[model samples]
Target: MKKMPHLSFWQIWNVSFGFLGIQMGFALQSANVSRILSNLGADLHALPLFWIAAPLMGLIVQPIVGSASDRTWNRLGRRSPYILGGAIIAALAMFLMPNASIVVSIMPVLLFGLLMFALMDGSFNITMQPFRALVADMTPEEQRNVGYSTQSFLINAGAVLGSILPFLLTNSLGIANTAPEGQVPASVIWSFYIGGSALLLSVIWTVVKTKEYPPEEYAAYKGLDVKAEIDPQYKGFFGFFRLLKITPKTMIQLAVVQFFSWFALYIMWVYTTPAVSQHVWGCEIGDSASQAAQDAGDWIGILFAGYSLFAAIFSVFMSKIATKIGRKTVYSIALLIGGIAYCSTFLFEGGEMMHVNLLFTQVDVPSSAVLWMFPMIGVGIAWAAVLAMPYAILSESLPADKMGVFMGIFNFTIAGPQILSGLVAGSVLRFFFGGEAIYMLVVAGVSMFLGAISVIFVKPSKSN
Candidate 1:
């Protein structure tokens, strides 16, 4: 067998750069969706349920994109066409989701938000699966770690920009931080506008700058003809499902871990705004009218930004550490740290108890803003591992041509748990935990520890 040529760092970087923009849109969705729903008067208890559309979209779209992209080759290349198409759809969704409130009635606004949320997530999946396959297609086995870690760095860096935009817009850019009851804030509106534009531009950069290896050369590197009968041109309605018959055991094990990890993450994304607003900032649960609660929501964005910043700077180091101690060991330790960090949120007494305070003139500041940043370090390291380790482990055992479809299947684990969490999170919070958001974090912490244990069972690979 001929050895695949190793790509230079610059070659690796150009492909990965698109993730920066993709993550921007994603980070915005994760950090702000709940807040947007709240501002539009969705019940806090029903908020988790609203997120169902996003995951359901992923559950359905990914496999189709994977299978379609696997069979596709054109002037735009195998993945770039999907990448460009998704970015455009997602950017438009970004513009529309928050602006859902501008509609005349609350029902229309709510439906609009859900529709846009679904589109953005579905479009994101279209790009995400292809990008994973792209890395595996271009890189040799030994350098896969570097390829994925670089992508992780770009993901986090984009997240840092996306997550902090509301804070920066209100504080630094002099945009209105609080809106009248039933309206979205100007700060948030502008942030999405800028992020959407950035997202499209970044993806365009990748499409223009990078060229795919032609089919024959790519087949040699991947060690398979992508045109095989198994994946042959998007033939049937349920075509991608054929690959499921021969699904690898390693992927199944890793999927279980992904379930818990993403479940924990979904809880954080859905509840953190309520937790910080009601517990830390002492605002009422249904008080979209209150400026204090809105400010608290912006600060949560800052906290998310803090973690992504840590991840951006820390991902490369974490990958190196994984090499020294073994990827599984490093991943387990990172999750444990993240678990502890999630639990720690329960200990904070809120802004009043915090010893130091920072200023954001338009919004209320959390006294422990500095302290909030620390927990993210744990989450950051784990986030880094989450972004890199599973892909590294799975790629070794997967057939090169089938990578896209398998990657699509892997998302089922993430989507299933998210769907489950949406169904039960509100009820669990109301009946089991008395609606105290802190307890949700406690649940999240325990879930992460379980995820750590589950990931240890990921089938070992020679590359890992």
Candidate 2:
């Protein structure tokens, strides 16, 4: 058998660039969906429940998608087809999401929007797993880190744009900034439109520009036959359940970290807009006209952008930081820093309480820049490990043929944390803090601290 050629830098970039589009869709959903739902009259306490579909769908979808993609091989390629399909679905869902309030007596529109989001989200996960595996399959062992870094950089860049679109479009284009109660404003509508287009185009670019290795190449890499015995019944619903019964102690131990990280993230996603408007600007729900709400929406976008900015800057520094003091130490410290940053959300309300810095010749302390960078720096460092380290350890330990199934099952930890956060964060705020959105940040802080502490116990695979 011929030795596989090493991929060039651009080759890695081309294959990974699709993540830019995928992350953009995710950025829009994470940063703006809660705020949009609030504009559509979702109560702060109820927001978590409304957003439950994303994680729940991910829980059901990711493993199934991963499993299916593991067996798939087609003309468009195993994962590229899923990417194109997801982009199209997400685009349609983005178009309709902001329009849900239009058909006044049709409750189904809301459910339809949610269902479309689920489909789009699930399809993306389907593409994501195979893409990760592709990187491992195609790259030489020495270049694995660089390959994944390119992918992460693309992911964050896409997220930066996705998180900032509302601010740029609303402020720059003069779109209708506000709408009557229960309506999404024109600015947000346009943001989603542009995002959808970018997402579709970026993924298509990757699909066209890059090619995956054939099954023979893949089989040769692992010393397996190109053709294998088929077990069609292994694809059944109960198959995942049966597989779920056996799991690694390492994965079970890491659940502690996943639970905390996801809980903190969910709190931030669900309440950041309300927390900022209510806590910083003293704008209560229905307190002022839609303009106040619109201002709140724009500010939310800016704050999300702040985090992304920090995340991008920090991504470059993560490898160095990890090298100086083991990856676990860096991860633990970053979590602690993130906990501190989350705590800052409760310290100010309605305006700037602490003078932070200036951005673009404007005082940005409280508007969206305060403490935002700090949390994100921590978040970025944490994200480095979240995407790579755990998987690295797992891949080194698991049997090669079973990688697909084990990795699928492993994502359950990510979904499990989200489920816990969705179940708890809202009630904690309502009952403990009297429905104040700021309190949710405190809950997030605690969760981060807990997640960080769990890092102490993560024993990387001995083989690695």
TM-score for each model: 0.95, 0.89
The list of candidate 2 runs beyond 4 A from truth reads 1-5, 105-109, 230-235, 285-289, 320-325, 352-373, 462-464
Model 1, residue pairs in steric clash: none
Predicted model with the maximum lDDT: 1
- Predicted candidate 1 versus true structure: per-residue lDDT over 67-148, tens digit per residue: 7787788999988898899999999989988888776565677777778888988998887888888888778988888889
- Model 2 lDDT per residue over 1-464, tens place: 45567898899888888888878878888877876776666666877887777777768766766676667678877566766776777777777777877665767545655665666566666656666766665665556556666676777788888887877766566667677777777877888888878888888888898887677776776566677754554547776676666556666777778778877887788887777677666677534245555566676776676666666666666655555676678667778888887886665555554453334323233444354455566565555556655554455555444456667677778777787778877788778888777778887888888988998998866322
Give the root-mean-square deviation of each candidate in angstroms.
Answer: 2.4, 3.1
Q: Who wins the TM-score comparison?
A: 1
Pairs with backbone N, CA or C atoms under 3 Å apart (clashes), candidate 2: 279-349, 280-349, 280-350, 281-350
TM-score of 1: 0.95
